[model samples]
Target: MACDREVRRAVSGLSGADAKVYELIESMESAGIVAVPELCEAVKASTITFVGFSCTFGDDGERSIDIGRHGFFERKTRSRTENLLSKLRDLEKDVRFTVFIDDMEFRRVWGWSRSQESLTEECEFQIELAREESQIPGDWDVELWSRVESRIECIPKVCLNTELWHQINSGVACAPINYEMVLKWAAEPAQSRALDEIARMRQTYPRNRNVKLSELRASSVTGLAVYSHAGEVLEFLHPGAIFIHSADHRRDHMLGYRRTKPLPIIHPWR
Candidate 1:
């Protein structure tokens, strides 16, 4: 109830289309109201595990938006950490494996920094710490956090070896990373030319359609470099890391879409 009140207060301050949407969201919470088309599509669409990443680097080689800027962050971190917590809870229960992709603007919009932990890392630690300190009985908090964290298997756009990267790039017309899908996810559609450009690229380098999830291996990431909207990199000192890259480098390097199989092994850290 307290959280609801706070959310109401926040929504009340929104104006224009934002306000209307939030109003509907509030209705959804209070009366189970929802936009019919979207609800219907969501209900009808085949469920798949999808993970998204924007570029971490700007055109100027600086840091871009960080985990704090994500919609799931509610324009602030820690204060709205519950939003992410809840998302992970859902992801664990529903998703099996996720497909990761990066955008070209990743480098153009935000530069990379060697510092700062990725949002995923932040989420992992925060949940783990919260569980350890929780007063809840049966250590349910820990179970919840563990349940969500263990299932995650992250893959990078760039392969660990340049040979694999070349192998993928040589056969595909376009770089295989699905930038179009990422843009659509953000409610931003690319121009037709841009779409065609990728299509042509894909045509020139037609990809092998038979790759299997089990054939892929997860990359060993040392640290996740987080980009900040303020145009800087945020650094975190942690052992486990998740790395992401952009597809804009497709013309110069190999970037391919690869499926993932849920590993029988859990995250060793958890």
Candidate 2:
């Protein structure tokens, strides 16, 4: 079989070690062991991609059977390669290959002639379960599993009076209204005293409670009321603490009133 057009183009510019590597892959392509169109195109474009290839050398440094990795290619491709490698090893030839993605290499098969009894056994089992026609195992309930493992509840809304809301909106307290801003403020060493004050206030009024913003401003322990208010604002805006609306109308009224209904539960997997 002729090597694919893309495969030839992919190795057209290479020399030395890189050229040797692709030559081994081309042999596998010609043998109908694996199709390399996607892999070849990625190489030709110099884009990052994953592929596995191996070369075996004799004691006299003669190169022998070269093959691609299992799992990356289709079942038939893997099966053919495995069978070919097995037959080659039966003749006492060394067979080995390394799996790689771009510059990173992994799971190198060294001394394959002496490693194991069967090459395709474990691969076949895994491929069968991964096939589109295969049914999920009976022991697993996907729906219940999702509900238990993948759900995130909405945070309760906080209520603030008009004056306190204006104070925050006017930027007098430099309140953080988003998760990233909260993280930035929290990381500052200068904000430590304000964070301590906020922590003390949390002990008295849990985060989920509908507390007035005025309470945070008045409860300053370090006498820096502005910093205390800003720190409290960051706590409210922390991830998993509250959902901040992007719309102007909703954002305008965010601290004005408490929401009567709970926000919808999030299913991250979906």
Q: For each candidate in turn, give its C-alpha RMSD to the true structure in angstroms.
A: 18.3, 26.6
For model 1, residues 1-270, the per-residue Cα lDDT tens digits are 874675455545555543443333333232232222222222222331212232222224343333222322222322323332234335332222221212322332233443333534444454444335441122122212122222221223242323433543453333333323233322223233333344344444334134332221111000011111100100111101111111222321111112111111111111
Each prediction's number of clashing residue pairs: 25, 1
**Per-residue accuracy of model 2 over 194-224 as CA lDDT, tens digit each:** 5454544544656625665545433332223
lDDT of each: 0.27, 0.31
TM-score of each: 0.23, 0.18
Tell me the spans in candidate 1 whose CA falls farther than 4 Å from its real position: 1-35, 41-71, 74-108, 113-175, 178-270
Scored by lDDT, the top model is 2
What's model 1's overall lDDT? 0.27
TM-score for candidate 1: 0.23
